[model samples]
Target chain A: MAVTDEAIEKIKGMIVSGALRPGDRLPKESELASELGLSRNSLREAVRALSLIRILDVRQGDGTYVTSLDPQLLLEAMSFVVDFHRDDTVLEFLAVRRILEPAATAMAASRISEQQIDALSAQLDKLGDSPSVEELVACDLDFHRGIVQSSGNSVLCSLLDGLSGPTTRARIWRGLTQEDAVSRTLHEHRAILAALRDRDGEAARSWATVHIASVEQWLRSTL
Target chain B: MAVTDEAIEKIKGMIVSGALRPGDRLPKESELASELGLSRNSLREAVRALSLIRILDVRQGDGTYVTSLDPQLLLEAMSFVVDFHRDDTVLEFLAVRRILEPAATAMAASRISEQQIDALSAQLDKLGDSPSVEELVACDLDFHRGIVQSSGNSVLCSLLDGLSGPTTRARIWRGLTQEDAVSRTLHEHRAILAALRDRDGEAARSWATVHIASVEQWLRSTL
Candidate 1:
């Protein structure tokens, strides 16, 4: 392994073995370098790399410490990575989303609070008929995010969030080019919200599936 | 933004905007640094960070280049992030897997070939009645991975692979401590394979679900 890789693995060993618990401040650079038998530069590079992935936090004047290592935080790295995906793979990403979002919606059906349902309904109402493409996109993201959050699985929520990046442009393009796309989206969102209000998991799941499937079908045809 | 973050974002913008296409060599460090108005150190750190996430590939004695940005390669970073997960969150990870693997399995039923089914069956048979815990874990991973790969969604396959890291130890623990767990797992694998052989997507999905739900049930009780 390269010197920096060795430095990274050593630090990862510390974290994984529980010697360096989350939020634990690291030893001084000089001390850690000597202890791990790595040069200071290699150690610093490793720290920077880990911090990029949110595995560590480097405060401006404070010591480097491990973050909470929450699935939400760790999987946030995925969204960053997803942003770099080439356009050809958007459908693959969407296929994964189609599987996940419906399950999340169904899970939310059982667990989503009445207040949360009302909140979602209110947000949908707030978007008047015939909103701009940008407004629709933002509301679409928020609406699904709200429902997924109710699934009570942080990992699921984070994965869906990460997977959404590559497909966002597809959505925007669909809205812009496909006449009646906006109305279809609005109608589907209302149907989903109604299903949730009725606590119908199967109906909610089916709605979420068709909602994403329509986007996938359109993108596939265009591609 | 931190200097390195600014540097990272500048590089990211180039790729996202299509100026830095995949496999394109980065400009010479000094020239690019000057062009971005970044010091060499910040640029170097940003490059290192991006490389760590598989966004950029640093070749020995060669130039840095943007990676293919393939979903598989990009999401490999998730498996690394998952390694740092605290034990308390393993269940959340498993829940996400439960949602995904069954769906992937169902997709596989329609697409999986006779040869693939034979190979899966052969592998399972090779692990005789008295397999070790390590063998069971390896086979279990290979089994689900084989099915998910047949699902033909690289993002789904990669996400499931990344999410599996946390629950691996849990699987091993259940195998070692829980009576009949190994036999039960083997039986479930057979059922899943049989369903796949019959090309029954719903049956495959249910078997996959119950298989994971059993592990989840066991882990929940222990936790």
Candidate 2:
């Protein structure tokens, strides 16, 4: 494991130092091993591990290459690990989302097109007053995602995407057991939508903070 | 690779569904492979990959087990991936930090201990007026990290830590070549420290935004 880790660092160092670049094919396994002063097996293990994380691409007979290293591809590993987090970890993710979502909302306020705002409104309309836990959870995810995507920062979008996964289950659990979960969430979404429609960044930010905080507050009291 | 990915998902599904939990030992290799309906070889590959990301722990002779799934541990994978990001990706990270650091500084303002504020003051003092590029870079990281840590959210701290890595290099480059880099950053740190000392979340937040924005602005113009 240590040898493989070292090899991984060497390969990553090459990327950081601009010796290897995105989409560049790596040298043959044997040659890279010698260049990095590692045994071929360790190098192969390192490559495999990195490939698993979407950092490297192993195309079978075509040879290994550096991935595009796009924020979406690299942060995919985060979504995987997020699934493993216990319920307790949700609070930490929420703390982060509280800071990010409101800021993202503010950015979106000025940038979101009329079409997008209409789509958001249409989305809320699709969720009637009394939706099931599953339906509510799906709508909730889409609503928050729509606003964050409008922020125009892919990294923020990806980070929030990863953070939102475990909480979606929590939201479902809340929707099933908590009183007025459906109506309360829908109401908050309506408030946030109005702010966005007004192109009021401050109001949008405030509404978003209030919206997510309501969920956090509920989680706190219930937990 | 596809088979290994499937095996990875199966193992992750177990964790997510609470069939397997943090620090839980797996059944012996053969039994676990059978349980997941995976070949032993594929299971081993999956485990190796997970271990690389700190999601699983592989003991030399002891059996493999799920790791604690701590935020710090899981997010370590992020730092590794962040290293592979292209120069343009730094902008995305900066955008995130711009949102997060201000919020984090605000949280820190009310919560930061007097001792911590003093420590930040001392940190700034150590940089002096004309520190070297390397010194300025290191101080710059520690200064921001100190405020974020005071926010008391490990996830936010880790995310910011990972985002700061490549930008540290950029800072060093700028410090070496740009005019008055050292004095400007030091002056900003002093302003943030003063706000933190006053327990003024709004001021702390504003100062943090200005401090980070200066760097972002520099990167925008230069990059």
Candidate 3:
């Protein structure tokens, strides 16, 4: 292994083995370097790498500490990774989303509070009809995010959030070229909300599926 | 942004914008650092961080280059992140897997070949009636992974692989403690394979669901 990678794995061993619990500040650089038998430079590089992935937090003028290691935080690194996906793979990403979002929506159906449903409904109403492509894209992200959050599974919420990156551009393009796409999206959102309001998991799931499937179908034809 | 973060974002922008295509060698460190207006140290740290996530490949003697950025390679980093998940969150991870693995199984039913089915059946038969906990755990991973791979979505396959980390220990615990767990798992695997053989997507999906739900149920009761 490379020196830096070795340094990284040692630190990871500490975290995973519970030697360094979340929010625990590290020992001084010199002490840790000696303790791990790594050079200071290799240790610094490893810390930088871990921080990039949200595994560590390097406070200015303070010691480095482990983050909460929450699924949401850890998986946020995935959105960064997903941004680099090739165009050919966007459909695959969308297909995965098609599987996940509907399940999340269905889960939300059983657990989503009436107030949460109203909040979602209000967010849609605030968008009104005939919004700009940018507005629609932003609302679309928030709309699904709100619903997925209700699924009560942080891992699911984070995975769906991470997987949405590649499809964002597809949504913008669809909204721009497909003239009726805006109205169709709004209509679908309302249908999904209605299903959630009625606590109909199957209906919510089906609506979510077709909603993403339409985007996938449109992108497929265009591609 | 921190200097290293700015440096990382600049490199990421290059890749995402098509300037730094996959497998493209990065410019000489000094020259690229000057062009990007970054100090050598920041650039190096950024390269190290990006390489840690499989975004950039650093050759010891050769120049650093962009990786394939394949979803599989990119999301492999997620498995690393998934390792840090807390005990309380294992159920959330399992819930996401339950949603994904079933869909992947259903997809596989339509696309999996007779040859692949034979391979899976052969794998099961090789495990024999009695096996060690380690063997059971390894076979269980390969079994679901084989089915998910047949699902024909690399993103889905990678995400499922990443999400399996937390549940791995859970599987081992179930295998070791529950007397019927091993037999039950073997039976379920056969049922899943039979569904695939018959090309019954719904049946395949249900078997996959119950397969995971049983593990979830066991883990829930234990927890």
Best by TM-score: 3
Q: Model 3 reaches what TM-score against the true structure?
A: 0.95
Candidate 3 wrong stretches, greater than 4 Å: A166-177, B166-175
lDDT of 1 by residue, B45-152 (tens): 888899999999999788889998888888888888888887788889889889899999999999999999999999999997776767777888899889999999
Residue pairs with backbone atoms closer than 3 Å in model 3 (clashes): none
**What is the clash count for each candidate, in the order shown?**
0, 0, 0
lDDT: worst 10-residue window of model 1 chain A: A166-175
Docking class of 3: high
True contacts kept of each: 0.79, 0.66, 0.83
**Which ten contiguous residues of candidate 3 chain B have the minimum total lDDT?**
B166-175
Lowest summed-lDDT stretch of 10 residues in model 3 chain A? A166-175
Candidate with maximal DockQ: 3
Docking class of 1: medium
Q: Name the lDDT of candidate 1.
A: 0.87
Work out the TM-score per prediction: 0.94, 0.89, 0.95
Instruction: Using TM-score as the measure, name the better of candidate 1 and candidate 2.
Output: 1
Which parts of model 1 have CA positions greater than 4 angstroms off? A166-179, B166-179
